[model samples]
Target: MTEDTAAGNTEAPANPQVKMRVLGQFIRDMSFENVMAQKGIAGDVQPEISVQVNLDAKKRPVEHQFEVSIKLKLTSKAKGMEDVLFLCEIDYCGLFHVEGVPEDQLHPFLLIECPRMLFPFLRRIVSDITRDGGFPPVNLDSIDFVALYRNELMRRQAEQANKTEA
Candidate 1:
Protein backbone atom coordinates (compact mmCIF):
# COMPACT_ATOMS: atom_id res chain seq x y z
CA MET A 1 0.00 0.00 0.00
CA THR A 2 1.07 3.58 -0.59
CA GLU A 3 2.44 5.58 2.30
CA ASP A 4 -0.68 7.81 2.30
CA THR A 5 -2.95 4.75 2.45
CA ALA A 6 -0.86 3.24 5.20
CA ALA A 7 -1.18 6.48 7.18
CA GLY A 8 -4.95 6.74 6.42
CA ASN A 9 -4.38 10.12 4.86
CA THR A 10 -6.85 9.57 2.01
CA GLU A 11 -8.37 12.98 2.24
CA ALA A 12 -6.93 15.87 0.27
CA PRO A 13 -4.26 17.99 1.84
CA ALA A 14 -5.50 20.69 4.20
CA ASN A 15 -5.91 24.08 2.54
CA PRO A 16 -2.96 26.36 2.99
CA GLN A 17 -3.33 29.35 5.27
CA VAL A 18 -4.43 32.07 2.89
CA LYS A 19 -3.31 35.54 3.78
CA MET A 20 -4.68 38.77 2.29
CA ARG A 21 -3.80 42.37 3.03
CA VAL A 22 -4.95 45.64 1.54
CA LEU A 23 -1.98 47.58 0.28
CA GLY A 24 -3.90 50.50 -1.18
CA GLN A 25 -7.42 51.53 -1.97
CA PHE A 26 -8.62 54.41 -4.10
CA ILE A 27 -11.31 55.63 -6.43
CA ARG A 28 -9.99 55.09 -9.91
CA ASP A 29 -12.81 57.03 -11.56
CA MET A 30 -16.04 58.67 -10.44
CA SER A 31 -18.75 60.92 -11.91
CA PHE A 32 -22.05 62.19 -10.59
CA GLU A 33 -24.61 64.19 -12.57
CA ASN A 34 -27.44 66.18 -11.08
CA VAL A 35 -29.47 66.36 -14.26
CA MET A 36 -32.57 68.05 -12.93
CA ALA A 37 -31.07 69.99 -10.05
CA GLN A 38 -31.09 73.24 -12.02
CA LYS A 39 -34.57 72.63 -13.47
CA GLY A 40 -36.37 73.12 -10.16
CA ILE A 41 -38.20 69.82 -9.90
CA ALA A 42 -41.02 69.62 -7.38
CA GLY A 43 -40.11 68.77 -3.78
CA ASP A 44 -42.45 65.77 -3.70
CA VAL A 45 -40.64 64.06 -6.59
CA GLN A 46 -39.51 60.48 -6.04
CA PRO A 47 -36.97 59.09 -8.46
CA GLU A 48 -36.48 55.43 -9.25
CA ILE A 49 -32.85 54.45 -8.94
CA SER A 50 -31.05 51.44 -10.37
CA VAL A 51 -27.56 50.36 -9.52
CA GLN A 52 -25.34 47.84 -11.31
CA VAL A 53 -22.26 46.24 -9.74
CA ASN A 54 -19.38 44.53 -11.47
CA LEU A 55 -16.08 43.09 -10.22
CA ASP A 56 -12.83 42.38 -12.00
CA ALA A 57 -9.37 41.18 -10.95
CA LYS A 58 -5.91 40.94 -12.45
CA LYS A 59 -2.64 39.54 -11.14
CA ARG A 60 0.45 41.67 -11.12
CA PRO A 61 3.91 40.62 -12.27
CA VAL A 62 4.99 40.56 -8.65
CA GLU A 63 4.33 37.35 -6.83
CA HIS A 64 1.46 37.18 -4.37
CA GLN A 65 -0.07 40.45 -5.44
CA PHE A 66 -3.28 41.32 -7.27
CA GLU A 67 -5.43 44.28 -8.23
CA VAL A 68 -9.17 44.06 -7.76
CA SER A 69 -11.67 46.66 -8.86
CA ILE A 70 -15.37 47.15 -8.27
CA LYS A 71 -17.41 49.21 -10.67
CA LEU A 72 -20.79 50.70 -9.87
CA LYS A 73 -23.24 52.43 -12.21
CA LEU A 74 -26.23 54.23 -10.79
CA THR A 75 -29.09 55.71 -12.78
CA SER A 76 -31.91 57.71 -11.32
CA LYS A 77 -35.09 58.83 -13.05
CA ALA A 78 -38.19 60.42 -11.67
CA LYS A 79 -41.40 58.43 -11.63
CA GLY A 80 -43.62 59.12 -14.66
CA MET A 81 -40.79 61.13 -16.22
CA GLU A 82 -38.64 60.10 -19.14
CA ASP A 83 -35.71 62.32 -18.30
CA VAL A 84 -32.98 61.03 -16.02
CA LEU A 85 -32.53 62.69 -12.64
CA PHE A 86 -28.94 61.68 -12.09
CA LEU A 87 -26.30 59.27 -13.30
CA CYS A 88 -23.35 58.16 -11.20
CA GLU A 89 -20.56 55.82 -12.13
CA ILE A 90 -17.50 54.91 -10.13
CA ASP A 91 -14.58 52.51 -10.51
CA TYR A 92 -12.95 51.71 -7.19
CA CYS A 93 -9.79 49.70 -7.01
CA GLY A 94 -7.67 48.05 -4.31
CA LEU A 95 -4.18 46.66 -4.36
CA PHE A 96 -3.99 43.39 -2.39
CA HIS A 97 -1.32 41.08 -1.11
CA VAL A 98 -2.55 37.50 -1.46
CA GLU A 99 -0.39 34.60 -0.44
CA GLY A 100 -0.62 30.83 0.10
CA VAL A 101 -3.70 30.52 -2.12
CA PRO A 102 -3.56 27.76 -4.66
CA GLU A 103 -3.38 28.68 -8.32
CA ASP A 104 -6.54 26.75 -9.12
CA GLN A 105 -8.47 28.65 -6.46
CA LEU A 106 -6.87 31.99 -7.26
CA HIS A 107 -9.58 33.20 -9.61
CA PRO A 108 -12.41 32.67 -7.14
CA PHE A 109 -10.33 34.09 -4.28
CA LEU A 110 -9.65 37.22 -6.30
CA LEU A 111 -13.16 37.60 -7.65
CA ILE A 112 -14.98 36.74 -4.47
CA GLU A 113 -12.84 37.27 -1.37
CA CYS A 114 -10.81 40.25 -2.55
CA PRO A 115 -13.81 42.18 -3.82
CA ARG A 116 -15.74 41.30 -0.70
CA MET A 117 -13.01 43.05 1.22
CA LEU A 118 -13.20 46.15 -0.97
CA PHE A 119 -16.97 46.51 -1.41
CA PRO A 120 -17.84 48.49 1.74
CA PHE A 121 -15.61 51.42 0.81
CA LEU A 122 -16.90 51.33 -2.73
CA ARG A 123 -20.49 51.40 -1.50
CA ARG A 124 -19.74 54.32 0.77
CA ILE A 125 -18.23 56.23 -2.11
CA VAL A 126 -21.39 55.80 -4.15
CA SER A 127 -23.53 56.93 -1.28
CA ASP A 128 -21.38 59.95 -0.45
CA ILE A 129 -21.20 61.09 -4.06
CA THR A 130 -24.95 61.01 -4.43
CA ARG A 131 -25.44 62.91 -1.19
CA ASP A 132 -22.84 65.48 -2.15
CA GLY A 133 -24.69 65.98 -5.42
CA GLY A 134 -27.60 67.48 -3.48
CA PHE A 135 -29.79 64.40 -3.42
CA PRO A 136 -30.65 61.92 -0.71
CA PRO A 137 -27.87 59.46 -0.02
CA VAL A 138 -28.14 56.34 -2.14
CA ASN A 139 -27.12 53.51 0.10
CA LEU A 140 -26.19 50.55 -2.07
CA ASP A 141 -27.50 47.19 -1.01
CA SER A 142 -25.01 44.58 0.08
CA ILE A 143 -23.64 42.54 -2.81
CA ASP A 144 -23.57 38.74 -2.97
CA PHE A 145 -20.13 38.14 -4.38
CA VAL A 146 -20.48 34.38 -4.38
CA ALA A 147 -23.67 34.55 -6.42
CA LEU A 148 -22.10 37.03 -8.80
CA TYR A 149 -19.08 34.81 -9.34
CA ARG A 150 -21.22 31.76 -9.95
CA ASN A 151 -23.40 33.61 -12.44
CA GLU A 152 -20.34 34.92 -14.27
CA LEU A 153 -18.86 31.43 -14.49
CA MET A 154 -22.13 30.08 -15.84
CA ARG A 155 -22.32 32.82 -18.45
CA ARG A 156 -18.76 32.21 -19.59
CA GLN A 157 -19.35 28.48 -19.79
CA ALA A 158 -22.48 28.98 -21.86
CA GLU A 159 -20.64 31.31 -24.20
CA GLN A 160 -17.85 28.82 -24.63
CA ALA A 161 -20.32 26.02 -25.31
CA ASN A 162 -22.03 28.12 -27.95
CA LYS A 163 -18.70 28.92 -29.57
CA THR A 164 -17.75 25.26 -29.65
CA GLU A 165 -21.08 24.34 -31.20
CA ALA A 166 -20.57 26.95 -33.88
Candidate 2:
Protein backbone atom coordinates (compact mmCIF):
# COMPACT_ATOMS: atom_id res chain seq x y z
CA MET A 1 0.00 0.00 0.00
CA THR A 2 1.29 3.49 -0.85
CA GLU A 3 2.19 5.59 2.20
CA ASP A 4 0.20 8.58 0.82
CA THR A 5 -2.87 6.38 0.36
CA ALA A 6 -2.52 4.96 3.87
CA ALA A 7 -2.25 8.53 5.21
CA GLY A 8 -5.55 9.30 3.43
CA ASN A 9 -4.26 12.44 1.69
CA THR A 10 -5.43 11.35 -1.73
CA GLU A 11 -6.37 14.72 -3.08
CA ALA A 12 -4.00 16.60 -5.34
CA PRO A 13 -2.41 19.73 -3.85
CA ALA A 14 -4.28 22.88 -4.78
CA ASN A 15 -2.12 25.20 -6.89
CA PRO A 16 -2.45 28.97 -7.07
CA GLN A 17 -4.76 29.36 -4.08
CA VAL A 18 -7.81 31.56 -4.57
CA LYS A 19 -7.08 35.26 -4.69
CA MET A 20 -9.47 38.16 -5.13
CA ARG A 21 -9.26 41.91 -4.79
CA VAL A 22 -11.73 44.69 -5.32
CA LEU A 23 -10.04 46.87 -7.88
CA GLY A 24 -12.81 49.43 -8.00
CA GLN A 25 -16.57 49.97 -7.90
CA PHE A 26 -18.96 52.41 -9.41
CA ILE A 27 -22.60 53.21 -10.19
CA ARG A 28 -23.37 52.26 -13.72
CA ASP A 29 -26.81 53.91 -13.76
CA MET A 30 -29.42 55.24 -11.38
CA SER A 31 -32.92 56.68 -11.59
CA PHE A 32 -35.38 57.76 -8.94
CA GLU A 33 -38.92 58.86 -9.73
CA ASN A 34 -41.11 60.34 -7.07
CA VAL A 35 -44.51 59.19 -8.23
CA MET A 36 -46.55 60.49 -5.32
CA ALA A 37 -45.30 64.06 -5.60
CA GLN A 38 -45.67 64.10 -9.36
CA LYS A 39 -49.19 62.76 -9.19
CA GLY A 40 -50.09 65.03 -6.25
CA ILE A 41 -51.05 62.10 -4.06
CA ALA A 42 -50.55 62.93 -0.42
CA GLY A 43 -51.69 61.17 2.72
CA ASP A 44 -50.38 59.65 5.92
CA VAL A 45 -49.59 56.13 4.80
CA GLN A 46 -47.42 53.08 5.14
CA PRO A 47 -45.40 52.03 2.14
CA GLU A 48 -45.09 48.58 0.65
CA ILE A 49 -41.84 48.24 -1.24
CA SER A 50 -40.85 45.51 -3.63
CA VAL A 51 -37.22 45.08 -4.63
CA GLN A 52 -35.88 43.05 -7.54
CA VAL A 53 -32.22 42.29 -8.11
CA ASN A 54 -30.37 41.02 -11.16
CA LEU A 55 -26.67 40.22 -11.44
CA ASP A 56 -24.31 40.27 -14.37
CA ALA A 57 -20.60 39.63 -14.89
CA LYS A 58 -18.20 39.98 -17.76
CA LYS A 59 -14.49 39.83 -18.42
CA ARG A 60 -12.85 43.18 -18.90
CA PRO A 61 -10.35 43.94 -21.62
CA VAL A 62 -7.66 43.87 -19.02
CA GLU A 63 -6.54 40.38 -18.14
CA HIS A 64 -7.49 39.14 -14.67
CA GLN A 65 -9.97 41.97 -14.26
CA PHE A 66 -13.69 41.34 -14.36
CA GLU A 67 -16.74 43.52 -13.97
CA VAL A 68 -19.62 42.35 -11.84
CA SER A 69 -22.74 44.37 -11.41
CA ILE A 70 -26.18 44.25 -9.84
CA LYS A 71 -29.27 46.07 -10.92
CA LEU A 72 -31.84 46.82 -8.21
CA LYS A 73 -35.38 47.86 -9.00
CA LEU A 74 -37.58 49.02 -6.20
CA THR A 75 -41.23 49.97 -6.46
CA SER A 76 -42.96 51.53 -3.52
CA LYS A 77 -46.68 51.82 -3.09
CA ALA A 78 -49.02 53.17 -0.46
CA LYS A 79 -50.42 50.42 1.73
CA GLY A 80 -53.87 49.16 0.72
CA MET A 81 -53.97 51.20 -2.45
CA GLU A 82 -52.71 51.24 -6.01
CA ASP A 83 -50.73 54.44 -5.53
CA VAL A 84 -47.06 54.29 -6.35
CA LEU A 85 -44.96 56.32 -3.94
CA PHE A 86 -41.65 56.03 -5.72
CA LEU A 87 -39.79 53.93 -8.24
CA CYS A 88 -36.05 53.45 -7.99
CA GLU A 89 -33.58 51.60 -10.13
CA ILE A 90 -29.82 51.51 -9.69
CA ASP A 91 -27.07 49.55 -11.38
CA TYR A 92 -24.05 49.24 -9.17
CA CYS A 93 -20.87 47.56 -10.32
CA GLY A 94 -17.52 46.35 -9.06
CA LEU A 95 -14.28 45.54 -10.83
CA PHE A 96 -12.51 42.56 -9.36
CA HIS A 97 -9.05 41.11 -9.78
CA VAL A 98 -9.44 37.36 -9.48
CA GLU A 99 -7.15 34.41 -9.82
CA GLY A 100 -6.93 30.66 -9.24
CA VAL A 101 -10.66 29.91 -9.51
CA PRO A 102 -11.36 27.04 -11.87
CA GLU A 103 -12.97 28.00 -15.18
CA ASP A 104 -16.02 25.83 -14.52
CA GLN A 105 -16.71 27.64 -11.24
CA LEU A 106 -15.99 31.19 -12.40
CA HIS A 107 -19.53 32.09 -13.37
CA PRO A 108 -21.00 31.29 -9.99
CA PHE A 109 -18.11 32.99 -8.21
CA LEU A 110 -18.57 36.15 -10.21
CA LEU A 111 -22.34 36.25 -9.77
CA ILE A 112 -22.33 35.34 -6.11
CA GLU A 113 -19.16 36.56 -4.39
CA CYS A 114 -18.70 39.78 -6.34
CA PRO A 115 -22.27 40.89 -5.82
CA ARG A 116 -22.11 40.12 -2.11
CA MET A 117 -19.27 42.63 -1.89
CA LEU A 118 -21.25 45.22 -3.85
CA PHE A 119 -24.63 44.94 -2.12
CA PRO A 120 -23.91 46.96 1.02
CA PHE A 121 -23.00 49.97 -1.05
CA LEU A 122 -26.19 49.47 -3.01
CA ARG A 123 -28.22 49.35 0.20
CA ARG A 124 -26.77 52.62 1.39
CA ILE A 125 -27.46 54.20 -1.97
CA VAL A 126 -31.07 53.01 -1.85
CA SER A 127 -31.51 54.47 1.61
CA ASP A 128 -30.09 57.85 0.59
CA ILE A 129 -32.05 58.04 -2.64
CA THR A 130 -35.33 57.23 -0.93
CA ARG A 131 -34.66 59.80 1.76
CA ASP A 132 -33.67 62.42 -0.77
CA GLY A 133 -36.63 61.72 -3.00
CA GLY A 134 -38.97 62.70 -0.12
CA PHE A 135 -39.89 59.28 1.18
CA PRO A 136 -38.69 57.59 4.32
CA PRO A 137 -35.41 55.81 3.82
CA VAL A 138 -35.74 52.27 2.55
CA ASN A 139 -33.20 49.94 4.04
CA LEU A 140 -32.94 46.81 2.00
CA ASP A 141 -32.99 43.39 3.60
CA SER A 142 -29.99 41.10 3.36
CA ILE A 143 -29.79 38.97 0.25
CA ASP A 144 -28.87 35.29 0.16
CA PHE A 145 -26.53 35.01 -2.82
CA VAL A 146 -26.06 31.26 -2.48
CA ALA A 147 -29.79 30.62 -2.64
CA LEU A 148 -30.10 33.11 -5.45
CA TYR A 149 -27.40 31.39 -7.46
CA ARG A 150 -29.00 27.98 -6.89
CA ASN A 151 -32.41 29.29 -7.89
CA GLU A 152 -31.02 30.83 -11.06
CA LEU A 153 -29.31 27.57 -11.97
CA MET A 154 -32.55 25.69 -11.37
CA ARG A 155 -34.47 28.19 -13.47
CA ARG A 156 -32.01 27.81 -16.34
CA GLN A 157 -32.22 24.02 -16.07
CA ALA A 158 -36.00 24.22 -16.18
CA GLU A 159 -35.83 26.47 -19.21
CA GLN A 160 -33.54 24.02 -20.98
CA ALA A 161 -35.86 21.15 -20.09
CA ASN A 162 -38.84 23.02 -21.50
CA LYS A 163 -36.95 23.77 -24.70
CA THR A 164 -36.05 20.15 -25.07
CA GLU A 165 -39.63 19.00 -24.45
CA ALA A 166 -41.10 21.47 -26.89
Total clashing pairs for each candidate: 0, 0
Worst 10 residues of 1 by lDDT: 36-45
Question: lDDT, candidate 2, residue 94?
Answer: 99
TM-score of model 2 (CA atoms): 0.91
Q: For candidate 1, what is the TM-score?
A: 0.87
lDDT of 2 by residue, 25-111 (tens): 899899999999999987788999998988999999998899999999999989999999899999999999999999999999999
lDDT of 1 by residue, 20-91 (tens): 999999989988878887576657678899888888899889888899999889999988888788999999
Number of the predicted model whose TM-score against the real structure is largest: 2
Model 1 spans with C-alpha error above 4 angstroms: 1-14, 38-42
lDDT of each: 0.89, 0.93
Query: Any residue pairs clashing in model 1, and if so which?
Result: none
